[model samples]
Target chain A: MSIRDLARHLDISIGTVSRALNGKSDVNPETRERVLAAAKKLGYVPNQSGRSLRQGTTNTIGFMIESTIETADNGGSFFMPVFEGVQSVFRRHHLDLVALLCGTDEDPSAYLNRVVGRRFVDGLIISATTRNDPRITFLLDRKIPFVALGRSATGGAYPWIDLDFEGVAATAVTRLVNFGHNRIAIGVPASDINLGYVFQDGYKHALAANGIPFDPALVLPAHSNEEGGYQVASAMLAQKHMPTAVILVNENMAIGLYRRFYEAGIHPGRDIAVIGFRESTQSRFLSPTLTCFRISLRDLGIKLAEALLSTMPAFRNNYPQERVELIWPMELVPGESDVLKRTA
Target chain B: MSIRDLARHLDISIGTVSRALNGKSDVNPETRERVLAAAKKLGYVPNQSGRSLRQGTTNTIGFMIESTIETADNGGSFFMPVFEGVQSVFRRHHLDLVALLCGTDEDPSAYLNRVVGRRFVDGLIISATTRNDPRITFLLDRKIPFVALGRSATGGAYPWIDLDFEGVAATAVTRLVNFGHNRIAIGVPASDINLGYVFQDGYKHALAANGIPFDPALVLPAHSNEEGGYQVASAMLAQKHMPTAVILVNENMAIGLYRRFYEAGIHPGRDIAVIGFRESTQSRFLSPTLTCFRISLRDLGIKLAEALLSTMPAFRNNYPQERVELIWPMELVPGESDVLKRTA
Candidate 1:
C-alpha cells in the first residue's frame, strides 16, 4: 500500500502522513497513530532515495575491498572477524554499512567514478592498501572521507588502524631465543602486500636486536598459505643445516608447518619451536595449542567503523595531526607448541 | 586534481576529459590519449555522485545481516565466504556491495523500512531467516527484490539457498548404523533458530529411514558451539548406557567433543566414532582427520547473490514463485575418526 492509501484511510493529507512517518514533530499524536496503523496494516515502507534527497545524508558508510585479489588470496576467513567488529559498532551507532567490492584490474579511477562521482556513500573504509595506490590518490583528490586498515610503509601519512606487527614478531623471536634456540628462521609471504613487509621487517629487526646477524638463507618467503608453509618448511628441513625454531607470519602457515614437522618425524615443542601470528578460535583445541600473536579481528572492525564515522577527509587534504594512526598492540600467547622455560 | 585542470593542460574540453576517463565514446582517439596522459600526470579523477545522478543505477547491491544476534552468537565468521562469493560476482558484473548490519532487538520492520523507504539499494541479500519474520513480509509487501541464504521451514515461499542438512545427516547416521553401531546419539543446538530445526529433522528422518525408532534419550540438544559440544558429550558419556557413535551438528562442537573424548581416555576413531559438519579451513588437517560434511561457504555467498539479483518487482508484488531452494550436497571424507567397519 502506498502513503496515499494510508492518508486516504486516515482522512489526512499525504503530507501529514509523510511527516508522521518521518518522525517530524508537526503531526498530531492521534492522527500519527492512525496513519502508522494504516501503513503497517498495508505494509507500506518508505523509500531511501526520497529521504536521501530530502535529508542530504543516508547515514550509511561504505566498505570497499579489492574483490578479485581478496578471494584469490583467500583473505575472507581471516578478515571476517574484522567485518563483524565493524558491524558491531555500526549497529550501536544506528549506521548502515554499504560494502563495495572493486577490482585492481579496473582503472583505479573507476572506484572513484562510481563511489564518489555518484555520491553513493557518505564515507569509505578501505582494506589492503598498497604503496602508491591510485585509489588513495583518487579519494584524496576528491576530498572524500575515508580510513585505511593498514598503514603505508612510506610514513605515518594516512589515517589507519593497524596491528603492531614489528612488536609482535620481536616478542615471538625473543621467546624462542630465551628457550635456547639460536638458529632461528622466519617465514613470510613474498608478495609486496603491506602486511607482508611489516612482518618481514619485524622479523629482521628482532634478529638484529638479539645480536644475531640476519641469515638470508633462513628467511623463507612463500604464498602465505598452508601449502606454501608446508613446502617452505619441508624444503628448509631437508637442508643440511636446519633452524631449531621458526616464526611463521600467520596461523594458516603455522598449521602447515606443524603438519610438515610431524611428517618429518620432528615433534613441535620438543625437537623444534614454533611461534606464529593471529590467534584463531580453534587454536586452543589443536592437538598442540599454537603459541602465537593475538589480535582482536573484531576490535579492528570496531576501530575501522569509528574511523569511517569520524568522516575524516582523505589524508593529503587533512592536517598531519588530524590523520590518526590507531595501532593495536599484539600480545603473545604462549602455548605447548613453544618450548619455553616455565616461570613458575 | 579536477578534470577541468587536466582538460586545460591537455588543450581539450572538460567533456573529452570526462568521457576519456569514463572510457565512453564521443571523444577522438588521440585526443583521448592526450586527455588520459594529462589526467594521469595531474592525478585527475571524476566525481561519482555527478555521474551516478545522471546514470540512475548505482551498479551496486546491498547485503544486510542481523548484526546484533549474529555477532553475539558466531562473531560473523560463518558469513565471510558468502560475502566473498557475492563479491566475486559483483566484481565480474562491475557491481558493488553495500553491507548493513541490523539488530534483532530493534523492530524487524525497521530493516525493510530503511532499505525500501530510502531506496538506498537496488537489491538485497539476507542471511539467517527466522520463522514468521516481519522483514520477509515487508520485503514481500513492498515488492522489493531480495534473496535469503537459508530456506524458511514453511516450504518454498521465498528465493533461498541452503545446505542439504537432512540428506547429510541421514547419510552420516546411516553410515554409523551400517558400522554395527546400535546405540547412536545426535547432538544439536537447543535454540529456536531455523538451523536447529533443520538439523533435528534430518537426524530424525535418518533414524526413521534405517528402521530404528527415534530415541529421545540419545538426542542431546545444547548450544551449537565448541563449549556446548564438550559439555553435552561429557554428560552423554557419564550416562549408564553410552552411545557408541555421536553425530554433531557443527564442526566446532565436534572439536570440543574430541577434546572431551581425549580427556576421558577414549580416542575418537578407536573408542567413539564421531561425525559432524566441517566449516573450518584447518579441519581436514586435524589429527586422524575428521569425518564431517563440507559445504563451500563461498559458493553459498555466490548463490545468495544470484537469488537477490534475479528478484523482480512482479515477484515482489504478486508473491511470484519466490521460493528457490538450492541444496548443497555433502560428501563424506574417510577419516580415522570414524574407523568402524560396515556390518550390512
Candidate 2:
C-alpha cells in the first residue's frame, strides 16, 4: 500500500503518515499509533530506496567472490562454510548478507566499482586477492568499509585475514625432510594470486634451511584444482628426475593426482609420498587418507566478520581493535598419504 | 558528487541538473550534453537509491539460497556453475545478480518478506523449495516476478524448473531389478523437501511395475550429504535382511557410504550394488566409480534464467513462453558401483 492510501485511511496528511511510519518524534503518540496500526493492518512495506536515500544505509553486507572454471571446481566448498559463519554473526545484528559474484567476463575492479557506486551494501568482504589487487586500491580510495579475505601487496592500511600458506609449505617441507627426502616438488597456483607467491617463498626458504639448494625445476605451477593436480603429476613424470615426495597447495587436486597416479600404478602412500593443503570431504574419503592441514572454516568466517565490522564506524565499538591483519593457522592431520619413508 | 554539487559547478538549478542527469525530455539538449560531460569529468556516480526511487526498478536480480549445515557440506559445488550461467544471461541485459543467503536462524518466508518489502530486485530465482512453501504464497500475494529452481506442492500459477528425481529413482530401480535383485533399498532425504516425496513415489511405482510388493522397510531417509550416506549404509547393515541393491538420492552420500562399507568389509560393486543420484568430482574419483546421473548445471542455470526472464514483464518478449514448468532431465553415467548381478 502507498503512503497516500495509508494517509487517506487515517484521515491525516501523507507527511504525518510517513513521519509516523519512520518513527519520527514530531508525530503525536496517539496519532502515530493510529497510523502505525492502519499501516500494519493494510500491509504497507516501506520502500528501501526511499529509506536508504534518507538514512544512507542499506542494512546489508556483501561478500564478493569470483565465478570461474577453477572456482566452479572447488571454490564453493571453501566459501560455503565461511558464508554460513558470516551470516550467523550478521543475523544477530539484523543485517543481511548477499554474495556478489564477479562473472568471468567482467574484471574484478570493474565489478567492485559498479557495486560500490550503487551503494548496494554497507560493507564488503572480498576474497581471492591477487598480488597487486586493483580492487583493494579502488576500495581504499573510496573509503569504503571492507575486509580482504587474503593479503595483497597493494600498499593499504586495510584489514585482511589470510591463510598461512607459507607456514603450511614450510611445515610440509620439514616433515618430508625429516623422512630423508632430498628431492621434493611443490605444486602451486600458476595465477598471480598472492598466496602462490607466499607458498613458493616458504618452500624455497625451507629448502635453504635444510641445506638443500632450491631447484627451479621442482616447482610446478598450475590451476589449484583437480585438473591442475593431474597436470602436476603428469609434469612430474615427464621431468628428468621425479621427486620422491610432493606437496599440493589445494586438496581438490589430490583427486586428480591420485587418478593419474592410479592409472600409472603409483599409489600415493606406497610409490610416492604426498601432502595435501587442506582436509576436505573428498580428502577424507580418499583410499589412502590424505595427510592435509585442517582449519575451522566457520571460525575463520566469524573472525572475518569481526574484522570487517571493526573497520566500520557503525559497529566498530562492538568489535574494538587497533588492526585486524592476521594469518590464519592450520593444523596438520596425519594420514597414510604421506607415510612413505625415503632412504638418504 | 551530489546533485547539488553538480548543479553549483554547472551554474544550474538542482532541478535542471537532475532533469539533465535523468535524461528527462523537458531538459534542453545543449544543457543535457553539458551536464553529462561535467558529470563524467567530475566522477559523479548517480545515487542508485535516488535513481531507483524515481524509476521503480533496481536493475538487479536475486537468487535466493539457503545456508544450512547440510548446504555447507555440498551446496557450493551445486550453485557456482548455475550462478555463472545466470550471470552470463543477466550480464547481457546489464542486470546484476546477487545471491541472497537465507540464514538457518531465520524462517525463509520471513526473509522473503523483508527482501520483497525492500524491493531489492526486479526478479528472483529461489532454490531448494520445500513442500507447501509459504514463500511461494507470499510472493504470489505480492505479485513478484520469480521462478523456482525446484518445484513445490504450493498451488500457484508460477514457473518452476525441477530435476527429474522421480525418473531417476524409477530408472535406478528398473536397472537394479534387471540385475535380478528382488529387494532394493533407496536412500532419500529425511526432510519434507518436495523431491524426497517425488523420488519415493518413483521407487514405489517402479517396484509395482516389477510385480514386487511395496516395502516401507526398504526406504531410508537422511540428510542428502556424506554423513547421511554413511547413516544409510549403517541402517542397511542393521536391517533384518539387507537389500542386495541400493540407490542414493545425492552423489555426496557415496563418500560416507563407501567409508562405512569399507569399515564393515562390504565392497559396494562386489558385495552389494549401488547407484548414486548425480555424478560429481567425488563420484569420478570413487574407487569403484559411482554409477550416477549427470546433468549440465550450467545449462540448467541458463534455462532457469530464461524461465525467470519469461515471467518478468520487461524481458518476457525475449523469452516468450506460455509457462516455464519443466522437469530437467538427467542421463545415467554407467560406472562399476552398480555392476553386481544377482542370480535369482
Candidate 3:
C-alpha cells in the first residue's frame, strides 16, 4: 500500500494524511491518530531507504550513550531528563530521537563509524567524552553534524555543553574553606574521563586560592559510584591526619560514605562535613540530607539539541549562529551534610 | 577502499580481514583493532543498506523503551543491567543492540510502527507491556521476529519473559500473615500495565488463602515511582486503621515511603513491616536495609535474547523448542525492614 491509497482509505486529504504521517504539528490529534491507524492497517510501509536517499535526510537524531556499569549505576538519572528536553525541541521540527547505546565491551569510535556510515540518523549527540576523544576526530573528518555532551581536549572546534565540574569543585572548596576547613579531602574519579581531570584541577586551584598547601595524599581516586565513596571514607580514616571535610565528585557515593561512617559510629553533620556533586531524589532524602549542586537537566538537553541543529546545514537557519560551547552551571543546595564546624 | 584493498594493505589474509570485520571470536583482539583502525583511516564505508537488502537482514536488534517520567524516575536502574546482559549475548552473534526510546508525548504503538516499517532491526524486544498492548498485536500481524519483555492480554501466541509479580505478591503476603499481621496493604501501579493486575490478583488470592477478608481500601494504586510511594504512605496514614505491614511492587517507592515514615516519627521495622519488590544498589544501602527480592537482570537479558532468537527463522535451530512464555522467578532476601511481629 502507498500514501495515496492510505489517504483514500482514511477519507482524508492527501496533504493532511502526509502531514499526519510526517508528525507535523498542524494536524488535529484525532485526525493524526485516525490516519496512523489506517496507514498501519493498510500496510503502508514508507520507502524509508529510497526516500532518505532522495531527500538526503532521515529526520532522525541519535543520542549515543554508553551503558557501562558506572553509567548504569547512575547515568540513567542524568540522561532521562536531558532526553525529555531534547525531545521537546525535536518534536516541533518533526524529528524522532533514538538512543544509540554503546555496549561496555564495544569500542565507541568503531560503533560511531558503523552508525554514521549507515546514514541512519541526521545528526548525533555523543556523551561520556574522554580526553582527546577519537569519535570527535572521526566525526570531524567525515564532516558529520554532531554535538558532544561533554568537553574534550580533541583538536576539533565542535559544540559541547558540559556540566561545570570545575565550577562545582571550586564552589564546594570555597564553601568548605569558609567553614574553617583547612584539612580537606576530595574524592576524584579514577577513570580517564575528562570530568575527573577538570574536577581535580578546580580543586587544586581552589586550594591554592585559599593559601593552603596542596597535599597529594588528600586527593583520593576511586570508581565514581557508591563503592567509590566508601573507599574515599576508608582512605580518609586511614590518613595520618584525617581531613576536617570531604567533597565527593559523585553524589551516589554519599550513600556508601554514610554507611561506612555509620559502621564506625560517625555522623556526617555532627562528626564530619561532606559535600556531594549533584542533588537527586535519592540525595535529597538521605539522612542528614546531602549538600549538593542542582542543574536543570531538561534545559541543558534543550540547549544540546539547539546546538546540534545549528551545526546541521538543513536546520542551521532555525538556530542562526547559535554555535554553543557551554559550561552549564550548577547551583549549590545547602543541606545538613556539610554543617560541621572545625575545632582548632 | 574495499575489503580486498584493506587486506592487501595490512598484509592480512582476506578471510581473516572479513572475519575481523564481522566481529568473529576467532580473530585476535589486536588483529581486529588493526582491521578496524585501518578500515576507519582508509575511509571504508560499508554498503550497509545494499548488504542488508541483499542478505534480507540488518544484523541489528532494537529494544523499545519508553522514556516517560514514571520510567525515567526508576526504570534506568532496572534497564541498564538488563541492557548489559542483552549486549553480552548479542555481541557473540555480531548483532548490535540499539534502544528505541519512545518520547513521553508520543504514542508507543505509532513509534513501533515507524521503527518496524523502517526495517532498521532484524528483530525487536518490547518492554512495558500494557493490559491490552497494541504493539504486540501489530508485531504479530506483521509476522516480525520479536519478544515481549512483559506479558499482555493481546491475542496471538508470542514469546514473553516477565518477572513473577504474582508469585512475589503471594509470597510477601504469606510471610506477612505468618508474622501475625492481618491488616496488610499493597501499593500497585496506577497505570493499566499488566503487572499491576497480576500483582493485585495475586494479593487478593493470598489474602483469601490466609483466611483474611480482602478490603478494596487496602489496595493502593500509585504512579510506580518514589512520589507514588510517598502518596501510598500518606493514604495509609489517613485511613481509619493503619496497616501493620505493607508491600510495594516497585522498589524505588521504598525510598519515598521511608522518607514519609521517618517524617511522621515512625520506625519501619519497629512500627510497620515493609517488603519491597526488588533489590537495588540504593535499596541495599537504605537505613534499616530493605527486605526485597533479587533476580540477576543480566541472566534475564541473556534469556530474553535467546528467547527472541528462538522465534527468528535464521536462529531458530540454535534454540529449538525454546518458545518462551516464562514467568521469571525472584528470590526473597530478608532484611531488617520486616522483622517486627504484629502486636497481639
Question: What TM-score results for chain B in every one of the models?
Answer: 0.79, 0.93, 0.88
Provide the TM-score of chain A alone for each candidate, in the order shown. 0.86, 0.93, 0.89
Model 2 chain A lDDT-worst window of ten: A335-344
Off by over 4 Å in 3: A1-43, A341-344, B1-43, B341-344
On DockQ, the candidate that comes out on top is 2
lDDT string for model 2 (B1-344, tens) is: 67788999999999999889888999999999999999888767777777788888888899999888667778888999999999888887888999998987779888887887777688899988998898898888878899999988899899999999989988999998998888899899888888999999999999999898999999999888878898999999999888888999998888788888888988888889999997886576666789999998989988889998988888889987778999999999999899964344
Instruction: Quote each prediction's TM-score.
Output: 0.84, 0.94, 0.89
- Candidate 1 local accuracy as lDDT? 0.70
In the range A1-344, model 2's lDDT, one tens digit per residue, is: 67887888889999988899879999899999998888778778887767888888898999999998767878888998899899888877878999999998789988887887678699999999999998988888878899999998889799999999989998999999998888999999988889999999999999999999999999999888877888899988888878989999999888788878888778888889999998886667666789999999999999999999888888888886878999999999998898874343
Worst 10 residues of 3 chain A by lDDT: A47-56
Interface DockQ per candidate: 0.35, 0.66, 0.46
lDDT of 3 by residue, B1-344 (tens): 55788899999998999889989999999999999999878978665655655576778899999999878887788888899999988887878888888889899998888887677689999999999999998888778999999988888899999999989999999999999899998999998889999999999999999999999999999977778888889988889989989999998888788878888988788799999999888666677789999999999999999999888888787785657999999999998899874355
lDDT by residue (B1-344, candidate 1, tens digit) is 55677777777787777888888887788878877777766655454334444554556677776654333335344655566688766676666776665654455457657665555566778766665466776676666677876666543356877778788788888999899887888887775557767877888888888888888888898766667778778977887999999988777677678878787877788888888776455466565567887777777777676666656542233233445668777677667677854344
